[model samples]
Target chain A: EAGVAQSPRYKIIEKRQSVAFWCNPISGHATLYWYQQILGQGPKLLIQFQNNGVVDDSQLPKDRFSAERLKGVDSTLKIQPAKLEDSAVYLCASSFGRTGGKETQYFGPGTRLLVL
Target chain B: SQKIEQNSEALNIQEGKTATLTCNYTNYSPAYLQWYRQDPGRGPVFLLLIRENEKEKRKERLKVTFDTTLKQSLFHITASQPADSATYLCALGSDSWGKLQFGAGTQVVVTP
Candidate 1:
């Protein structure tokens, strides 16, 4: 079984520039998630998708950040007009959507975005 | 104002000793709490999960104790080794499906 895969392990962009991160979840996993982790902090949930439908995105910055899980397997998170404050690691994870049981999430090597 | 807090400072413990880490939260009633281990430059890996109804859960040398009334969780690694050095994160999962709130994470360093 393959683990969750992400592209561009590291990225650098200037302030006000746009950046995008992509994630390919584990096969047969029904749930996918995107999180942002600032230095010295835990990963913060940005968005969650269950079978192509968004389950939650309350912490997402609607003004600049957006994400989509197309066809329920591949997902992408984009931040337009990136700010220096957005310099942090973006993590992607996937889990089996099992009801009435604990779902353990498998994470991918995160993309480190450094905004100048 | 909901918040989950873990020790921001790194904990230094000698190998073969027990290492204990604490996670405390306020303003949230979580159905389950989870622990994850993360090394530098990598994502976190799930270690353990304890439900609200359960008082304690153990796996190998890892033990997690949850006290709902106190809103605290303690993670203990017995017979600890230098390989156990990493940042440990605590996450809260509420009744709302797929929602997990994480703390700032606590780093543990074990020296030989």
Candidate 2:
């Protein structure tokens, strides 16, 4: 079976520019997540979706960042007016289950974004 | 606030030796602790998961130990090889759901 897939493995943009990313989770996976990994730091959860419904997005910057999972399979994350600090690796992950215990998450290669 | 910490210093060891990495946490009680390996320009791949109730778990040459009392987890790679050179991250389910909080990770370099 194929793993999680993402597009535009690398991206470059200027500050205040807009950018978007796409993700396709593993087949039959029920939970999807987006994370931001800054250099030398672990990935931070930005948003989570379970079958096209958001489960958590408390850390997401609502003012400029937004994400949606349409049809419960494919998802998109967007950042408008990007800041230099926003330059990081955006990773998409999918899990076999919905809740915490015993569920394993599989990640994609990630989209590396650089804002000048 | 909850915090997870891994040694920022990179671990260097000779091939065929054992590599031990530590993960320490504060202000949180996680039911399960997970370990992942990430290569440069790639996403993290899950390696192991040890539960709070379980003291130790092993798979092949990899071993993980969880000490809930100390709120710490240790990951060990036995008979290490150069292929084991990667950044290893420790994570926990921060919420009741599967939302995870990850540590900064410890990079291990296994030299020939």
Candidate 3:
């Protein structure tokens, strides 16, 4: 089976510019997730979507970061007025069930973003 | 706040030897803990998961031991190979819906 898919494997933008990342989860998967991984660090959860509705976004920087999963199959994460600290790899992951802890998550290749 | 920590240093081991990695957490009572393998320029791949009730789980040559009393998890790779070289991440989750907190990861290098 195909794994999660993401667009624009790499991106570069200047500070204060805006950047967007896209994710298409695995077929039939019910849960989608977005994570940010800074260099030499683990991926940090940004937001989670369970079939078009948000399950959790407590870590999301609501002031500048936003994400949406309109159809429950694909999702997008956007960061406006990017800062140098925002340079990191954006990962998208998916799991089969809504009760997620037990299921294995399939991850995409990730989009590596660099802010100048 | 809950914090997860893995050894930031790299583990260098000779092929055919066993490599062990550790994950420690504080201020978190996780129901389940997971391990993932990440290579350079790539996202992490799920390796194993162990629940609080379970003491040990094994897959192939990999073994994971979870000690809730100590708030620690140990991962062992037996018969290690060069292909096993990668960063290993530890994640903790409390709720059933799977919101997770991750550690920075420990890098392992196996040399032939």
Candidate 4:
């Protein structure tokens, strides 16, 4: 019944620093996703996880970004050695399941990251 | 490479009128198309979704039409109000489930 929840609604770090974000998805949801949204642009998928296993991560900057869904209920996305260009809102979303067609993604408030 | 596009310019309309936004794609056939509304400082909220086979879907005052041949989707909001003012994004699903390609949103402002 609860919506997706994300922590550290706002984050500020200098370039070359590290930051991490946490998300609690809706109960029973099995599909989770992380997205980066720059101002005036759509949210770009960074990675996707299906119950602790990654399904897609081609867009993720593996050199600096990593995410994990330990127990399939919650997820964490981390960015290390941040660049000034890494400044954006990190959004976490979840869906009902893999087989649910046209499954709507429920989003959290998102964590705003500012790399100075 | 697949590409999705929405009007980069903001759309401004008078309240009680119908507001229409467009999304166009190229180089890929989508299985389904989705629309979401986003406000400043928040994440996008799902609004409507229409499958490739479906030509149109409606919810209350919101309507979405998808044309695979044209590779476009149009989102409409009837009797628009200030509350309807926000950035609307269109998304197309990838071959794999849960992988969606999104378009840059079109900001709509309904002025009374």
Candidate 5:
């Protein structure tokens, strides 16, 4: 059973530059999620997708951050004109079922981004 | 406003001892609570989940207790090992869709 997979284990960019991340979830998983984890803090949900449709994205920074889950299998999260504070880890997680809040989520290694 | 807090200070424990961590929240009645283990530079891995109605749950050597009255959760790792060293996070889920609010996390270092 393969877990969620992400690309570019680490990234470094200057402030105001653009960065994008990719995520490939586990097979047969219906719910996908993207979270931002700052240093010393737990991961914060940025967006959630259920079968290619966005379930929630209230915490997403609409002005600069955007994500898409096409075909409900793989997803991407992008941040443009990034700020130094955006330096953090971006994690992708997936669950086999959407049984409300009870499903266990499998996480990827995450993409660590650093904005200078 | 809702807030979730974990011990900001790290817990250092010897191997074969029990490691206990706490998670406290305010202004929110979560439907369920979850605990995760996060290694340095890696994403968190799910450990356990306890609903509001459940008082305690266990998996192998890990035990989780939820107290809705106090709005707190306790995570315990029994017979701890050096491999248990990592940051532990507690997340609260308030909605049916599984939206979660996470705490700052507590670092645990188990030395052999």
Candidate 6:
């Protein structure tokens, strides 16, 4: 089976500019996740989607960040009016929802966003 | 608030040795903790997971121990190889919601 897929492996944008990242989860996976990893830091969960419905997004910056999982198979994360601190790598992961508690997450290659 | 801490400095170890990494957390009790291996320019790959009820779990050369009283987890790789060089991240499943909270990660360099 194919792994989780993410697009635009690298991106660079000026502060205050808008950027968007996309993710396509593994086949038959019912749970999708988006995480942000700053340099020298671990990935922080941004949002989670369980088959088209959001499971958690408490850490998401609603003022500047937005995410959606249309139809539940693919997801997108967007940052508008970006800040310099927003420069980080964004990762996408997927797992089966039924046994998610014990299942391991399969991560994508990730998208590196550089906010200049 | 819950916070996870791991060694920030990179660890250098000769190949064939056992490399052990530590993960300590504060403020929250987790039901399960996980380890993931991340290489430069790529996302992390899951290595192991241990629950609070379980004291230890092993797979191949990898071993993980969870100590609830100490709020710490130990990850060990025996007979390590150069290919095992990577940043190892420790994560916990949130008690309230079971979401994953990750640590900064510990970098291990295995020299052949």
Clashes of each: 0, 0, 0, 0, 0, 0
Best by DockQ: 5
- DockQ of all models, two decimals each: 0.64, 0.74, 0.77, 0.69, 0.78, 0.59
TM-score: which is higher, 3 or 5?
Answer: 3
Residue-level lDDT tens digits of model 4 in A14-94: 999999999999999999999999988899999989899998999999999999999998999999989999999999999
Tens digit of per-residue lDDT, candidate 1, span B7-79: 9999999999999999999999989999999999999999999999999999999999999999999999999
Q: For every model shown, what is its TM-score relative to the native structure?
A: 0.98, 0.98, 0.98, 0.98, 0.97, 0.97
Regions of candidate 2 where Cα sits further than 4 Å from its true position: none
Compare candidates 2 and 3 on DockQ and give the better one: 3
lDDT of 5 by residue, B1-112 (tens): 9999999999999999999999999999999999999998788899999999999999999999999999899999999999999999999998877777889999999998
The interface RMSD values of the models, given in order, are 1.8, 1.4, 1.3, 1.5, 1.2, 2.4
For chain B alone, what TM-score does every candidate structure achieve against the true structure?
A: 0.98, 0.97, 0.98, 0.97, 0.99, 0.96
Per-residue lDDT of B57-100 in model 4, one digit per residue for the tens? 99999999999999999999999999999999999985657578
Clashing pairs in 6: none
Clashing pairs in 3: none
Note the Cα lDDT for every prediction shown: 0.93, 0.94, 0.93, 0.93, 0.93, 0.92
Model 5 regions lying over 4 Å from their true place: none
For candidate 5, lDDT tens digit of each residue in A1-39?
Answer: 888999989999999999999999999999999999998
The candidate that wins on lDDT is 2
Positional deviation of residue B53's Cα in model 2 after best superposition, in angstroms: 0.4
Candidate 2 chain A worst ten-residue window by lDDT:
A96-105
- For model 6, the stretches where C-alpha displacement exceeds 4 angstroms are B95-98
